[model samples]
Target: MANEYYEFFCPVKMVAGFKALEHIPFELSSHDASRPLIITDRGVRGVGLVDIVTKALEAADMQAIDIFDDVPPDSSMITVATIAALYREKECDSILAIGGGSVIDTAKGVNILVSEGGDDLRAYSGTGVVKSPLNPFFVIPTTAGTGSETTNVSVIKDDKTGAKVPFVSPFLLPDAAILDPRMTLSLPPKITAATGMDALTHAVESFTGLAKNPISDAYATAAMKKIVTHLPEVLKNPSDAAGRLQLAEASTMAGIAFSNSMVGMVHSLGHSVGAKCHVPHGLCMSILMPHVLEFNLSVSSENIGELLLHVAGSDVYASTPVAERPAKAIATIIALKEEMYALCELPRKLSETGSVKETDLEDIARMALDDGSMLLNPIDATFEQALSVLKKAF
Candidate 1:
């Protein structure tokens, strides 16, 4: 039976396809923004994507934009303050984020400070604390994972306390997202595979979580279908523009789906593993996803069973016995993992991550039990159950 109620909300406007980057000028202009502070990291800047985007802006008579290319992998309050100061000094009117999760989140943090009129971003750390909309923000993702472009939450690390601070508000979501195939065309094979798994995890967890509803399910399934088909294609042929576009779109859809419906145990443990083991978040998700789904089978069997149609082709879904579809779905996910591992050696177990030891599993499980995502899990796993899943993943 369905839940009594659910809510879905996504205000980010998506402009996708070839030459989508060329549309940024018009998108910013519509928001009355001309001088935008471009936020990116060295990796993206090194790839000369900044030059490509800048040329697009200059073509549209936007030549006075400011660029900040020093954002790090883990953004901090100091980083936010420094970028915010630059935005203020340059008198930038808007933000154009041109990279992945860290870069986009830094842009959002800068927007908060510039709009809310304060340098201490930590003050706004909590849910729904940002009451007013910030400056117009546009995101051009260089990676297809994270879905930070469409999510309403941003996490900035506190340099002094070594704590991850969270900021969440409807206003935090990007006003526009550009999903050009060219943006992801340069991704390495392993990154492409890991990020694709990240998107799949987002869609799957959203579909199986307690808050799922019809709208989120539609988006989740659609995203899963896109990922199942296009992820491997792009991995096999990085130059495939159509496949890249599908993955980019799938990531955004998964973001919208999970942002509304929320995620469950997979994310709970994945976050813990990432924090504890310093593994790539997508790699962590890929390792833990099947295990968590198996753990949730008693409660989420029907939901997991239904995912088979979306993850596998319709022929496989139809031929599988209805009673066994849930287990089949889990097997299919593991098969996808195997395929990815074959292509890129994407780790299929905690042991392969090199950073995670068996001794660390207890701490990861304890941390996962305390994670907020656990609240939305179909089953309220105790520490022992959580540890069991980690052990199985290990």
Candidate 2:
């Protein structure tokens, strides 16, 4: 049996719906942060989503002091320092990040530098290294994955060493998370599928991992059901506003779930593969989820079995035998991947991702063993086991 003692924490005030972007100015004013620095990437700016945020802020008579839209897909320590310098140069009082995970993570890093008054990002690299209150921050994620808007962690890559350093502190949590469907409506089909699967991976891992608690389980299950129902719905009907909103909300719920309970081997391996192969995080997550599920099924069969009801529907659950439900649940996830692939070429195998090479399996497995997320896996994985899973996944 899993340990009975556990704790949950998610302090983000989420404003979700079709036009939730409009409420950002009010939320910022509540924190007395009118001169906000808008942080984002060029991808978001290219789609004019930042314009939507700026227009809304203007309508509320609270325009941003400056907009930094040069954030890269992998947030670097140098980018964080540059953003902090810009924050100070612009005389900004708060941060309003408008993009995906990297943008939000960069904004969090900037907050750490701006509020704590330091140029050395290495000082706040480890878990809980930040002890002071951060500047007021809000996040508007244009992607339906990553849930970085609600999590209390930020990953900043070291430019000099190419190492990813994690920073964990409650201060990293945003004061508010705005989930507006308009922000994500223009996301490409491939990106939409990958991000949705990333959210599903988060839900599944958080639900079945060793640190699972009642509160986290509740959020995870809810997130799983929503993803199963809405992911395909939005895929079939890209303009389905309600479906997009549901996916976004599910992503946030999954973020809250994993943020509290933590993730497991899927994340460990995904992070390693992503770093080593330069594969997109969500694409790596989407491909590796089923393999991780099978690896963990021996220890978490009952929990995995319960997810069948959510993923495959009630009729399938009612007809399947209890003893066979876990395997069926794992199949359901694979089937989900196949269906997504049919819709938008979501890579089911690592080989299809174009970046992962055959010879990289050993190095990837070694990195997986070093990942902190591995500690929370339902079953401890040996070097041989991790390598076997990687080869099988390959």
Q: In candidate 1, what residue range of length 10 has the lowest lDDT sum? A: 57-66
**Residue 394, candidate 1: C-alpha displacement in angstroms:** 1.2
Give the number of the best model, judged by TM-score.
1
lDDT of 2 by residue, 91-170 (tens): 99999999999999999999999999989898988888998789999999899989889798998999999988899999
Assess each prediction's global lDDT (C-alpha) against the native.
Answer: 0.92, 0.91
Q: After superposition, how far is residue 76 of candidate 2 from its true place, in Å?
A: 1.5
TM-score of decoy 2 = 0.97
| Clash count list over all predictions | 0, 0
Name the regions of candidate 1 deviating beyond 4 angstroms. 1-3
RMSD of each: 1.1, 1.4
